[model samples]
Target: MNGRPVRVVENLNHALHESMLADSRLYVLGEDIADPYGGAFKATRGLSQANPDRVITTPISENGIVGVAAGLAMAGDAAIVEIMFGDFAGLAFDQLLNFASKSVSMYGRPHPMRLVVRCPSGGSRGYGPTHSQTLLKHFIGIPGLSLFEMSPFHDNRAVLAHMLGLGEPCVFIEDKVLYTRRMAGDGQVDDLFDYGFLGAGDTAPAHVYTEAHGDVDCLIIAPGGMAERALAAMRDLLLRHEISCRLVVPSRLYPVETDALLDAARHAAHVCVVEESTAGGTWGAEVAHVLHERLWGRLRRPVRLVHSADSVIPTAVHLEREILVQADTIVEAVLADLRGEGSPV
Candidate 1:
């Protein structure tokens, strides 16, 4: 009614516009976020048109922008800073990690860090090394910041609205590949993927796609872009290998939905995690560790993590295919484990 129904990009645009109108102090600040430019992915297309003064554009300096945003938040302004790429998040580390994340606790301040850093993350578009990085693992374990990744099935408008009210600093990641993908449907806020078990609770995990009814051979856990590939691989596993698995995807990266994850893993014979980030000190690694630690007795096989190669992303498409976890790689990994030919992580 308010605007046309949209895919991921437009949905995010809608959320940003609504949040600004709802709160007087909330403003958007980033490079080229103004109209016509509308950010690197056009998620902020009409935002500057509506609120010309509030949607502030700045020079190219991640550190300066983040530092300014932190200062504004301390002065009671709710600011959303959009970083063009996840790889450049390292440049803003001093402001985010040291000041924004620790300000509330250190200063014993009343108002929390009313800041949100929007990071466009993940890669499959041959962006090469620096432009294509997840960098999520680097931001985790910080005491005060929240981490969120938008999902196609889950309602982004609802999630962003809630996050804006949290009164804490947040790192919100937007996958580049998801920008053009249409929403699965006008789904209910609680329904992750038309499945019943995972609801819209704050701690609920997303049910990406599942066939784990009576006997589940494996439970495939993936995040962001990996969820789509994992679901595709699952179809092959069922038809060709006759292996059934459940796909559990999480929208929130930090403050993980531990209970929901554990429940899903307990019912499966094997648990496998897939991620776009490289192996070792990755989000997938953490997931596998937790599942192994908690459900070791319940699990029939050791937890496995299939991830991108631990090196800079490649420029060539073929090299990328070889490095990233494609449908074949996923199918191969799962089937190898099922056949007892591969070592589990």
Candidate 2:
């Protein structure tokens, strides 16, 4: 839809610029986000230079940053807070949970808290434990707080615009690795796979990519960051094993809409969820539960969840690889589940 294929980071930067130009009341608050530095991943690049007064660089305080954004949002202004590392978002839990989320419905009248906390998350790079973690699961189920992930299929411009228009607080999770990956444009992923949307055009819908012309044998559900891995596995399953697999990548994580998911998964014999988060109390687990309930008695086997090992992420590249979910992990999980080797949930 543009001159050249842009990366996720560029799309985000463009979105921020367009949003700033459209709305004078919007402000960007973050640490080391101003000027020459741009941001940790350059998602806010050129923003400070373009809008000096609106783009503010703050101290190393996640809580303070979010709190100030919330205050600004309450005053009828839109505020976007950028958390350099997704792990550090835990420091702002109180501000998000008690203040921003509740302010929407706690008061007699609904206060439009046009606040969006953009988190650069997920692991693949050797950023170590403190820097590389997907902590969005902790913020799930919080009232009035919507969760979103940046995907190649969905335009970041549309995502940012939608979040600002929601008039509510939202946590936008950006996979650190996805920043450099080329985004899919014109509904074209590649020559092998075809892409389509399952839900309404306006809202965030699950992106379905598949090579299968007939019924798919397996349906794999994953977030944006995990899309690459899911695709890799999808390719391996189709080419090496002759198995038809459909990959569904969703932009919205929490408060997940299941109508599209159920429609896509009902035909598949097996459903598998892949995530970078460690096993247990994960978004994948929640999805598995939902699939079990909705597709009960219609499925061939229980849903399988593929995730990282339940341990602290290591710094060494090889060690970290072992702990995190990889493309091979997904392929193995799908094969195992198909063979009836995966135990019941």
lDDT of 1 by residue, 1-345 (tens): 654447788878888888888888888889999989899999888998999888989899999999999888888888999998878989999898889988867875556778989899887899998898888888878988888887776567777766667778888878788888765553322232244337656325667444335558888887766767877788788878778888877777787778888888877888888877777787777777788888887777778878777788888988977877798888988887887775544
The collision pairs in model 1 are none
Per-residue CA lDDT of candidate 2, range 1-345, in tens? 657689888888999999999999999999999989999888888999899999999999999999999999999999999999999999999999999999999999988999999999988899999999999789878989999999888888888898898889999999999998998867667777878777666345655566433568999999999998899888999899998888888877888878878887887889999999987788888888888998988999888988888888998999999999999999999999988896534
Best by TM-score: 2
Query: Which number leads on lDDT?
Result: 2
Model 1, clash count? 0
In model 1, which runs have C-alpha deviations exceeding 4 angstroms?
1-5, 186-197, 201-203, 210-213, 342-345
